[model samples]
Each structure stands twice: as structure tokens, then as C-alpha cells.
Target: MDAFSEFIRGITRDNPILGLVLGLCPALAVTTSVENAIGMSVATAFVLVCSNVFISTLRKQIPSAVRLPIFIIIIATFVSIIRMVMEAYVPSMHAALGIFIPLIVVNCIIIGRAEAYASKNNVFFSFVDALGIAAGFLLVLVLIGGIREILGTGQIVAFGYTLLSLPINPAVTTMIMPPGAFLTIGIIMAVVNYQRAKKRAKGG
Candidate 1:
């Protein structure tokens, strides 16, 4: 496939969350607020992109029997670097994200791409694929986070700014909980499925 098509496929047809259903743990865990969601997405993106490039570059040299271990090492190194950077610069976000930052090493999205795409593809396309998949992840996380934040707290606040607020507080704190994450993702999946079905019917 061409680079553009590959990139678009990651965002749409193969999205880790809304499409392929990968990486739900962090998706559901850190999306209570938009700020936390953004932080997680950025950290995950850094690891995904860096690991993809490194793995693709070393794919030929790495033995197939031990490729997975090498992939983990590469992923962990990037995750640790980002973790320390976040700790030093954005300590609050770093603390809020907590274990999830380190957990990115095992995130299916990263390992899956390393094995499935990066290991097989050239460096440039691997980079493109990571960017596309990361964008898709960010898209879903922010959508869920924004919905929960607005409904649960009657407003949306990120980076010390109120992007949205409702008159006469209508906060429903339940929307910030685990059940709310399930409900929000369920509704989103339904909508996505409906749209895809409609497009198929229209012969798109």
C-alpha cells in the first residue's frame, strides 16, 4: 500500500481503540479528565513512534527467536526516557498518569505494531504508521475524556483553562467512573458501527 493509504488505514480501519479494540486499559483508566487523557496519549505516542523506528531499523539484525525480547527492550527504553522527562517537567501530569506511563511498554498497540508493521516495513512507512495510529488513539481518548469531563463535572478544564462550562451545574459524577467509561465507549462503538454499516449499504 502507498504511504498515504497506510497512514489513513491506521486512523480509520485499524484504530487501536475504536476499530481493533486494543489498548482499552489505559483508555478507560486515564480518561476521566481531558488533561490526563492528553498526557497519556502524548507519552504513548512518543514510545510508539520511537520504538517503531528503532525496531524497523534493526529488524534485519535481530534474530527471529529473540525479536520479541528485543522489541520489549526498545519499547521500555523509550518509555523510561519519556517517564523521566515527564517527571522532571510535568510532575503533576506525571504523577496523575502514574503507572500507566510505565505500562506503555506493554501496551498492545506498541507491541502489535512493532511485530506486525514495523518489523516488516521500511523506516519511513513505519514512522507514518505510528503517527497515524497515535493520532487515532489521541482522537478517541480526547473524545471520551471531553465527554466524561463535561458531564461529570459540568465543565471541561485542561491545562488550567476552562474550554467549556455549563450554566447551572449539571454534574453527574457517575460519568467519571468506570461504568461511565464503559458506557461512553459503548455508545461510541455503536455510532461507529452504525456509520460503517450505513456506508456499506451505500456502496462506499
Candidate 2:
């Protein structure tokens, strides 16, 4: 397979969040604003790329019987590193993310990629795949965050700077809440499915 095509596929065709439907918990939970979305994306991308490279490198020596255990350990190690780094440099985000940071250990996106792609691929391809998938995840989070933030707050702010300001007496508070997250996701899914159906009908 062409490496470039594979990388593009992860962003559009096989997006971990939008297409594959993996890693939805953080996508919904930490996407209240652009700031939170960026924070979560950075931590997740770090762990995903690190774990993919490491697992792919050792794929040959790792025995099948013990691969799952090995994968968990490897992924956990990276997750812990990300946790510490975020806590030290970005404590606010660290606290904001809460248990979800450590919970990355169980994130199916990480483990699933490790087993399904990393464990069988070369390091370079795995690295490329990780980058593409992580980028796709980040992009989706940012999009969702933007939508929710704008709808719920009537504005968008990042690092104390306002990116957008809308005139609304009272923003729809539900959009930033759990119900809002679900609603945004449901709408996006419906739109995506409709597009896919249309494409299939045209034999594309």
C-alpha cells in the first residue's frame, strides 16, 4: 500500500473517531471547548504515536500468546508519561481531563491499532498510521468542540482569547452538557451515513 494514501485514509476514510467510531468517550467528554479539545488531542496523540512506534518495532519478538499483555504494558507506559508531562506543564488541562488521561490505557483506539496494525507493520508505516489517525482524532475533536462551544457559550475562546462572539441572550446550555455531546455526535453520524449512502448509490 502507498504510505501517503494510507496516511490520508486515516484522516478521511478510516478516521478513528468519525469513520472507525473509536475513542468516543474522550471525544464527547473533553470537547466542551477548543482549549479542552486541543489538550486531550495532544495527550492522546502522544500516547498513540509512541505506543505504535514501540509496538511495531518489537512486533517480531513479541510472542502471540503474550502480545496482548505486552501491548497493554507498552501503552500504559506511554499514557503515564503523557499524564506526568501534562500535569507538570499544563496542570489546568491535566486536572480538567481527570481520569480520562489514565483511562487512555483502556482506549480501544490505542490497543486496537497496536494489535491490528502496529503489531504487524513496519515501524515507519506504523508511525505514519499513528500520525494520520491521531490527526483525524484531533480534527474531529476540534470540530465538535467548536460547535458545542459556539452553541453553548455564544462565543469561542482559546487561551483567554476570543475567537468568535455571537449575539444571543442565552446560549443553548444543553449543547455543552452531556446531552449536547450526544446530540452533536448523533447529528454528525446521520450526516456522514447519508453521504455514504449517496456515494454507494452512485457506485463510487
Candidate 3:
């Protein structure tokens, strides 16, 4: 397999959120700002890469009938590690993300990739696939978060760095709220679909 292609595919062609529409709960729940998005992204990425390696390394030994349970165990183990590290060092981010960190244990993105690709693939390819999907998730989370933070608060701050600010009232605080997540995702999906349609029409 072309390793780079496999990696890039997750960032674009098969984005878990934009293309596959998976794992919306945490995507919306914690994406109130770029910092939160990045926090969740890193946690998920760590779990994905570690789990991919752990599972792929044992693919041959894991019995098919009981593979799913094994995968969950491995994934949960890594998730627990992540929780501890976050709680110890980045407690603010850990507190901000809260249960969502544990929620990563059952995230469809993690399990689905573990089952569909990591289980059947070699260790290198599985690692690349997991990283690719994690990158895709990070990209979308940051984009949506940037929008919500800027519009909802009339400014955007990431990791204590101010990226942008407006001297006027916020556009709509609801954009950072639950309902706004659906609206933002809906608009983004619409734009993505439109671009796809245009590409198809141009025979590209």
C-alpha cells in the first residue's frame, strides 16, 4: 500500500466526520473552542495510534470469535492511561473534556477503525490509518471550533493565545451552544456536498 496515500485519504476522501459522519457526540460536545478541540484530538490520537499498534501486533494471536472483546480491552487500557496523564499534567484540559475522555474508549471512530482496518492490516499500515483518521478528526474539530469560538464569543483563543477578536458583539452565542453545533455541521456538510457535486459535474 502507498502509506502516504493511506494517511492522506483519512484527512480528505474518508474523513470520519465530514465524509463518514461518525463520532458526532464528542465532536460537538467539546468543540466550543480551538483549545478544546485540540485537547480532544490529542487524546483521541494517542489512543488510536497506541491501540492500532497494540491490536495490529496481536492480530494473528487474537481469535476471531473473541477479537472484538480483546480490542475493547486494549483500547480501554490506553484510554485509562490517557485519562491519568491528562489529569496529572493538563488537568484543565482534562477537567474541560470531563467524561468525554472516558468516552473515547467507546468512540465509534476508534473501534470501527480497529475492527475494519487495524485488525486485518499490518502494523505499519494500521498505524498510518489510525493517524490519518485522527488527523481528519483534528482538522474538522478545529474548523468547527474556530467558527463557533469566533462567532459565539466575538473572539477566538487557542491554548491561551488569542488568534482573533472582534470589538463588537458576538454574532450569536448559540453558535457555541448545542443547537449551533448541529447548525454548523449542517452548513459545513452542505458546502462539502456542493463542492463534490461541482467536481462531479466538471468530470474531475
Candidate 3: residue 143 lDDT (0-100): 94
Model 3 TM-score?
0.97
Winning model by lDDT: 1
Model 2 Cα lDDT, one tens digit per residue, 18-93: 8899999999999999999998988999999999999999999999999999999999999999999889998998
- lDDT of candidate 1 over 50-72, digit per residue (tens): 99999999989999999999999
Where model 3 places Cα greater than 4 Å from the true spot, the runs are: none
Which ranges in model 1 have alpha carbons more than 4 Å from their true place?
none
Worst 10 residues of 3 by lDDT: 166-175
Return the TM-score for candidate 1, rounded to 2 decimals.
0.96
Question: Model 1 has how many clashing residue pairs?
Answer: 0
Per-residue lDDT of candidate 3, residues 91-158 (tens digit): 99999999999999889999999899999999999999999999999999999998888888989988
Q: How far out, in Å, is residue 93 in model 3?
A: 0.6
TM-score of each: 0.96, 0.97, 0.97
Q: After superposition, how far is residue 178 of candidate 1 from its true place, in Å?
A: 1.5
In terms of lDDT, which candidate is stronger, 1 or 3? 1
Worst 10 residues of 1 by lDDT: 165-174
Q: How many clashes (backbone N, Cα, C below 3 Å) per candidate?
A: 0, 0, 0
Model 2 scores worst on lDDT over the 10 consecutive residues at 1-10
